[model samples]
Target: MNIIVTRPKEDGSPLKEKLETMGHRVILMPLLRIVPRPRAFIRKLPYQAIVITSANGIRALSGHTELKSIRMLTVGPQSMKAAKEAGFLKVEAHGDLVGLATHIRKTLNLTAGP
Candidate 1:
C-alpha cells in the first residue's frame, strides 16, 4: 500500500522509515516549516508553563534558555517524547490539545487554555 505522511520534514523522516519497514511506500511532504520568529528571545519572558503542540515546536523552542525553568506541557505522547529529547525535564503528556488545556487549567488553577 502507498501511504502519505504529512508532517514537517524533520519529523517525516522517522515515519518514512517506519512505514517503509512495514512494506508500504511512503511519500513525505512537510506540511509545515519552522522559521524562528524575529524576536525569538521574546518567548524567554516568564510564564506559568510551556505549551507544546508539536515536536517541531519543541525542537524550535529548545534553543531558548527560558524553557528550562517552565513546566513542560505536551499535547501528545510523541510530543512529550520530543520535549524530553529536547531537554525538558518536567514533561507532561495530556493526550491532545483539549486535554492539555484542561490539564493545564486544572493544574495551574486557571480558567484559560494551555
Candidate 2:
C-alpha cells in the first residue's frame, strides 16, 4: 500500500519508517509546521482545570513555571504522556474530545466558563 503522511517531518519520520517496515510505500509531504511561540506570562486566573487536546499544546506550555501547578485534562494517551513529561502533576486522559468533555461534565460539573 502507498501512504502519504502530511504531518510535519518530526512526526512523520517515525511513521514512515514503521510503514516501510510493514512493506508499505510512504511519502513524506509535511502539510503543517510547528512553531513554538515565545514564552509569555500565564495569567493567574480562577479556573478549575486546564484542557489540552494536543501534545503540541503541552510542548508550548512546557517552559512555563505554572505548568506543574494546574490540573490537566487531555485527549488521548499521547497528550497525557506529553502533559506528564511537561511536569503536569494532575493529568487525566480521555480517548477523544467527546470523552474529555464527558469526563469534565461528569467529574468537574462544569458546563461552561473559564
Candidate 3:
C-alpha cells in the first residue's frame, strides 16, 4: 500500500515511519508549513482574553508570565491541552471557531477589554 500523508511534518513523520515498518510506502508531504513567531516579539498586551486556534499558538506564548493570569480560549482539545500545560488557569475549549465565537458572545461582556 502507498500512503500520502498531508499532515504537517511534525505530525506526519511518525505515521510515515510506522507505515514503512508495516510494509507500506508512505510519502510525507506536508500541505502547510508553520512559521513560528519570535519568542521575544510576543509579550503580554492589554487584553481580556487570548483566543488560540492551534497548539502552536500556545507554544508561541510560552515563557510569557503575564499571559498566565488571563483567560485562554482554545479552538479544540489539542489547543486546550497546550494552554493547560502552559499554566493557564482559565482555559476553555470550543469545538470550532463558530462555537468559540458563540461562546465568547454569550459569556464575555463586550464592554470589557478584548
RMSD of each: 2.7, 1.9, 3.6
**Residue 32 displacement (Å), model 3:** 2.6
Which tens-of-lDDT digit does each residue in 1-114 have in candidate 3?
Answer: 999999779767877998999999899999988877666655446787888987767877877877787888889787788789889888999899999999889988888766
Find the candidate with the highest lDDT and give its number. 2
- Which portions of model 3 show Cα errors greater than 4 Å? 1-3, 12-26, 40-46
Q: Encode model 1's per-residue lDDT on 3-94: one tens digit a residue.
A: 88888778899989999999999999888777756536553344668788887678778887666667988899999888888888888899
- Model 2: weakest 10-residue lDDT segment is 105-114
Candidate that beats the other on TM-score, 1 or 2, i.e. the better one: 2
Cα lDDT for residue 55, candidate 2 = 75
Model 1 has an lDDT value of 0.80
Q: For candidate 1, what is the total of clashing residue pairs?
A: 0
Per-residue C-alpha lDDT of model 2 across residues 19-86, encoded as one tens digit per residue: 99999999999999999889977787766888998877888888886657788899988889878888
What's model 3's TM-score? 0.72
- Best by the TM-score measure: 2
**Residue 62 in candidate 1, Cα distance off native in Å:** 1.1
- Residue 71 shift from truth in candidate 2, angstroms: 1.0
The reply for model 1, stretches above 4 Å from the true place, is 43-46, 111-114
